[model samples]
Target: MNTKTPAGTEQITVSNITIDIVRKDIKNIHLAVYPPMGRVRIAAPFLVKDDAIRLFAISKLSWIRRQQRQFAGQERLPPREYKERESHYYQGKRYLLHIVEAEGWPKVILKNKTWIELYVRPGTTLEKRHALMTRWYRTQLKKQIPALIEKWEQIMDVQVNGWQVRQMKTRWGSCNPDQKKIRLNLELVKKPASCLEYIIVHEMVHLLERHHNEVFLAYMDRFLPHWRQLKAELNKLPVRHEEWGY
Candidate 1:
């Protein structure tokens, strides 16, 4: 039986690798390696013993090191300043930002397939500009998401009660299996459409199998045969600069 204890966080070292451990009222141990630094964390059931967790960590030492190395070598974009001529991505294409000062209503548009025209009032502050761009990204992502959800629902025979877009720092997407709801990271708008579909399918698959265990992987493989390739492509894309917190 799973313990209903409140979550607690602590750390342990195995073979010189520090692993963050969080004990929660969960059924199975969930291990994850987060990006931008490949920080390793394990969310285990409260009843699981520390010795077991340490053994698990020791077994995954090589995988942890590989993930850390991948993160260390991945390309990262510099901080966005929302200024003219700055490079930005949309649908896997790079375009220069073209700032246009206008009288009313800030809007974003694409011009000649080479520029992202961001129209704002004169002397707009950096924060406002960033917010405007984020809203635009959100709008664009929302437009594309429903169609993908509809497509996957029929194919996977799953019902998504609801979906939302959020600016997440650590995860690409997450799902509430019991609620049949999924939340996608707003940053996905900047990636290729295939990547977006991949994330949607991944989250939707969680509705069939809650944990990332063997059954979950089998479902993923059956539903999306080329999922591994898409996952690699998504991970290789340049991520935006942000102050990440554990």
Candidate 2:
């Protein structure tokens, strides 16, 4: 499809990687690798030339390629059938799902760290079963948020107005520092608890600095010294399967 270009944005391929360059009136060049498919982007000063941008990308060629490779190799959980013997995750631990049909309320319980027993009434529909499991995950994840937020708010000396969990396609967490609110991705309920806390701390730091610039990272370093490691671990976890819309 043909589309009109934004006033100063252009697309070019460099070092076998497609780079989207947006020219802005800025003091410095910024390069980023975004997720889902690891799209590379460069924000450059309005006067910068394509050749200079190519050279910059070339300098970071190895790093860019490595990031792309990691994205390409990221694993995904097959669509859930909500059937017996399927694998599921909680707190980064894998468990086989065991569906148990019974007479009472629907629930999910981890039995002996090896299996997740999902108790439901007979003849539940697929969507209802999925909702039951999703609700259980949300309940478990919510239980930990209050303590984590409280701990960080005191340590960071920041007040959070509110927080919630929801399905997000591309972000694990986001902060609205203006409103002092945080939103954590529900998918995070499947990752390690440490990873969850790491995201919380990262978002809370936005209260101090909004941009992911040097100041923001410095704050992260001060509060969570091992934040880089935690980020790596979180990224290493399998990403959720998303329905791509082109």
* Per-candidate clash tally: 0, 0
Q: lDDT tens digits, residues 1-246, model 1?
A: 112225454888777776888876676788777667677889898799988888888888889999889878888899899998999999888999999998999989988789999999999999999999999999999999999999999999999999999989878899999999999999899999999999999999999988776678789999999998998788777777763322
Q: On a 0 to 100 scale, what is the lDDT of residue 110 in model 1?
A: 81
Model 1 alpha-carbon drift over 4 Å, by segment: 1-7, 21-32, 42-56, 243-246
Instruction: Please tell me which predicted candidate would have the highest lDDT against the true structure.
Output: 1
Clashing pairs in 1: none
Considering summed lDDT, which 10 consecutive residues are worst modelled in model 1?
1-10
Q: What is the lDDT of candidate 1?
A: 0.86
Q: Cα lDDT of all candidates, in order?
A: 0.86, 0.84
Candidate 2: minimum summed lDDT over ten consecutive residues — where? Answer: 1-10
For model 2, name the residue pairs that clash.
Answer: none
Candidate 2 lDDT score relative to the true structure: 0.84
